[model samples]
Target: MLKTLGFAIICLLLFGRCAQQVSPTGGKKDSIPPNLIQSIPLNKTLNFKENRVELFFDEYVVVDNITQKLVITPEADNPYSYRLNGTSIVLNFKKQFQDSTTYTLNFGDAIKDFAERNPAKNLKLVFSTGSSLDSGRVYGMVKDVQTNKPLFDALVGLYNPTDTLNPAKQKPFYFSRTDSSGVFSIENVQTRNYTMIAIDDKNRNMLFNAKDERIGFLSKPISAGVDSVSYNILMALSDNTPLKVQRTLPKVNNYTVVFSKPIEKVKVTFMNKDSLPYMIENGEQIKFFNVQPHSDTTLVKLSVTDSLETSTEFDQKIAFQAPRGKERQKDQFTISSRPENNRPLANSFSYRLIFNKPVQTIEDSKIELITDSLTHETLKNFKSTWNETHNELTIEGKSFAKDTIKWEIPKGSVISVEGDTLARTLIKHPVLNEEDFGILRGKVIGADTSKLYKHFIIELMDDQYKVIDRQYSSPYNFIHIPQGKYFLRLILDLNDNKRWDTGQVNKGIQPEPIIYLPEKTLIKSNFELNDINITLPKAP
Candidate 1:
């Protein structure tokens, strides 16, 4: 009985060991992807004629998003259906491939191990139905024009010059994705005249959407052959969406028009023979005041143009709503001054007070300038001039002594158009001597000489990347900058709008070029950093 019981126990142990499953533990985890063991028709097979192919891996593998990751150069009209059979994947074509053509199948990170899910690296297969495969190859690196860094995973493609399909709308004839280093090498390409382009493909659809993607292109087509051709591409916004009125919000006294994108120029006029006072803000919004409750809704025509000179007219209806139930709180009236901190106010540097709204009045007698808390004088000779918008008031005239000074405004001294009164305020600053600051002088090279008068802007920024001072043209001299680390940025104001503008793809207009001084500029007090040269690229 004991022997029989021991035998039964042994049998139970054996059965349990056979039925239970457990993963191996305690060693280095598998970080490597499955390696391809073999292919049914074999890779690089020439004069191939097959409807189905099988890929074998040493370990069990999973096929992931093959439809999106598998790119067939000379893109296939019908996609291949793939299935995993244990350790192998079988691909069945929906239709036959082109006759006597070299085909490249780039299975980009689609095959991976089932256990760890590490993707198979560089899984590309080349085959040809002709006597020989196309040996053409194109290699290049893609970089961002703004950041000047490698653009990884950017799609680099080649297209036949005569193809009517747009790069933004269709896939390329042949393409390769950039690696981490922003280097791409498209192999097995047909030797022909092709237009090469690169794009940051945010969507996996393989089409360039100018509204969402950045693109780079060669100025002209290249005649590619068996020899490898090399070119560096730079990607930028290349935006081309037309200016559109996204929405119109009406208030009791005013209506605001918000645009879909930024515009350099805009003109709003009533289509039905009416005029309204309007002011544009930030190139994206236009606020029109209804001085007289002229109409509940009015037909207005908006004529707008971008920096690229692409213009569009939009006619829309503007409607106003009567004030009801607890009117919305108005924006808080805020005041701010520049040259803050301990930074000294230098010669010709005006002390300015900026407000959130248009200022209606300022009692000069209630404002006083105090020097070193000893001498006090009212704002008499100082020319307090409001800007065109009446939101910025510049006070200049009396040369402030180097000693610490303060500007004081008593309660109710200033008032805005909305009847908001200024509270008691004090702004103190110091006027330092010339020895406390340094000078930055630089010149821009390669800019169009004729366009330099007002079309180019050079800015000197502090270490924190804030614009401290700017000059309209170069050779530019930024005077009175405190001793610190600085940098330079140049803006090619192509439209002479005093700001940098992005590109428009439909108009074939690249962005207004911007170049940065690669290295930081160290400014020492009582010294001048001179002859900083900035070289601009040829206008696209």
Candidate 2:
């Protein structure tokens, strides 16, 4: 009995200790990357003639994704093969080194410690089969043209001026990838004239794929021998692919056609113009509604023009079907106000009511406007108008007094298409005083006179870069703006398209330039700011 009791007590004590969950405290993590302690045929070796090279690290290291991370400048026909042995990496050359030429082997983030996987940064080996290494270097940054944001990991390349092959067809002669700051440096250059280009390589392939990649170029070839030879590249989606129809989806109530890319303009027509359907364009899809249901297929012609100004016309056969079962149920009629509920309205702005479908009839007697939630007035004096689609109604008072107003819309007051009636609604709008606004006026000094004749879309943006008000002409004059901190932006309408055109790659045109006022403009209540001048960068 004594032995059994002792065994039970010992088992309970062991189980309790295990259940207490004691965590082993290791002192500190090994955050340091493996250091290169030694190298065979040491770095920057002159007249390097060895067929093999070895790199020894302080700790056991692993080579990761060497095929993608490794690069050899002045590309060779037969590159080296890499192998790992214990705490070292070996490179065996497959061919003899070129005579009197400099070479660079870059192992970008490929060598890391075996335990923690901490990568070794800036692992590059430079040598020459000649007496000295090349002293030329090219440094630059890559940024997005539209947003002016740094593009990380973009590939910058150099090519011989006489090279006939484009970036899409051939890899660059010398290339380097941009770091986190969008900066890239290609050292050991030959100090010759070369054409330079940068691309946001999505596929990790050195070759630029025009179908998806964004590319940028300098207007002239650069001489690498010049002091401080730096160039900034502006990258844009230089897609010049011709627009093609991908597929056509015809449904019971609507017909949709999908294209390979988003189109700028689209037109859908039939043999009988009288039977034209209402068309709506949403990016890459063109939707058609109200096409009379027919038992036989109808030939529909579609013409679309993409952003590149490439136009294509095609014919498709579609059969329209009738709605069945639950599909026949009428869509719920809805109306929403612009200022929403209990929101303040600006004086220059008009109160609007948007409906789901086109409105047919409006009963003026059922609509009432209450001033200060007290005095009731008829809307006969208020000017009301409908938008082109006849689905939005705008109500504007000839002149609004600084006061709160309530709008009461009774059910069935407004009738829309398909015999839909508006629901009851109560909304409030307040007309603010003139003292609550401010004015901003500025002159753009370097806007091209020719392009200004076309127009400059001047915008007044809030602190968050959201446009508050816009004007077409320059010497921006923005009035009746709420008091806030703001800035100015100018969209150069080079093509007079009334929009910023991100250039056409096939035409070799750069995007229309955009300029922003450097300093933030603060608008004080009832204050007018002036004398803010801006200069546009010279056209490329």
Highest lDDT model number: 1
Q: Which regions in candidate 1 have their CA more than 4 angstroms from the true location? A: 1-24, 162-165, 270-277, 281-283, 290-293, 307-309, 326-331, 335-438, 445-455, 459-469, 479-501, 512-527, 535-540
- Model 1, range 1-540, lDDT digits (tens) per residue? 999999999999999889968876799888989999899678889888887878999999998988888888888786678889989999999887888998988888899999899999888888998889888888989987765578999999887765364787768888888988999988887888788888888887777887668888775787667786688887887667666778878887668889887776676668775656565666678776554536767888878886556788888777766767685445566778876645566545577877766676888887888777777778865777876556777887565565777778887988876667877888877777788789888787765454443477898877776778787876788888788898788877877877666564444456667788888899989998889988876543
Instruction: Go through the candidates in order and give the clash count of each.
Output: 1, 0
What is the TM-score of each predicted model, taking all chains together?
A: 0.81, 0.79
Worst 10 residues of 2 by lDDT: 272-281
**Native-to-model Cα distance after best TM-score fit, residue 2 in candidate 1, in Å:** 12
Output the lDDT of residue 199, model 2: 82
In the order shown, the candidates' Cα RMSDs to the true structure are 4.8, 5.0
Q: Could you give candidate 2's per-residue lDDT for residues 1-540 as a string of tens digits?
A: 999999999999999988967657687888999888888778889999877889999899999998778888988776778889989999898877888888898998999999889998788888898999887788989988755667999999988765364777678888899988889988898988878888888987887877788988776688887375679988888676777778877666556778888787766677543343433345587655443444356677777788766678988666655566674455576778887876767645567888766567888767888777666666655788986546678888643445987788889888865566877877787766668888888777765454443466787778877777777766778887788898777888776777767675334467777777766788998998887766665544
Which residue pairs overlap in candidate 1's backbone? Answer: 239-504
